[model samples]
Target: MIKNEANARHLREANKAFKAIKSEKPMTDYAKAQQSIQENRERLKAERLAREVSSKDAAK
Candidate 1:
């Protein structure tokens, strides 16, 4: 009776924790991917500008 109730409570708590952890995983991964893409874009833009500046200097 009491033991059964305790077991049920433990199971419920474990399930809730599992759900919370599972739900956050996709959001965390998406945020990391978005950050990586943003960093890559910034790096590409900087490189393009640097090349343009170098070409102009060479022309002068």
Candidate 2:
């Protein structure tokens, strides 16, 4: 029974260590660039939509 408990403890500790390692992976440079580009695209799209709405309101 004691051996089983020790094995469970070791497994839990190992899982916690591996989970920490997996969760803290740094983003690569290419991924960072892609994320930046996506953010810029979304911002531009929002601006364009706002402009179009204003223009339509002006025409009315």
TM-score of 2: 0.62
Full-model lDDT, candidate 1: 0.90
Residue range 1-60, candidate 1, lDDT tens digits: 999999999999999887754344445788999999999999999999999999999999
- The parts of candidate 2 lying over 4 Å away from their true place are 1-22
What would the TM-scores of all predictions be? 0.54, 0.62
Misplaced by over 4 Å in model 1 are 1-27
Tens-digit lDDT string for candidate 2 (1-60): 999999999999999887845465689999999999999999999999999999999999
- lDDT of each prediction vs. the true structure? 0.90, 0.94
Q: Model 1, residue 28: what's the lDDT?
A: 79
Candidate 1: lDDT of 45? Answer: 100
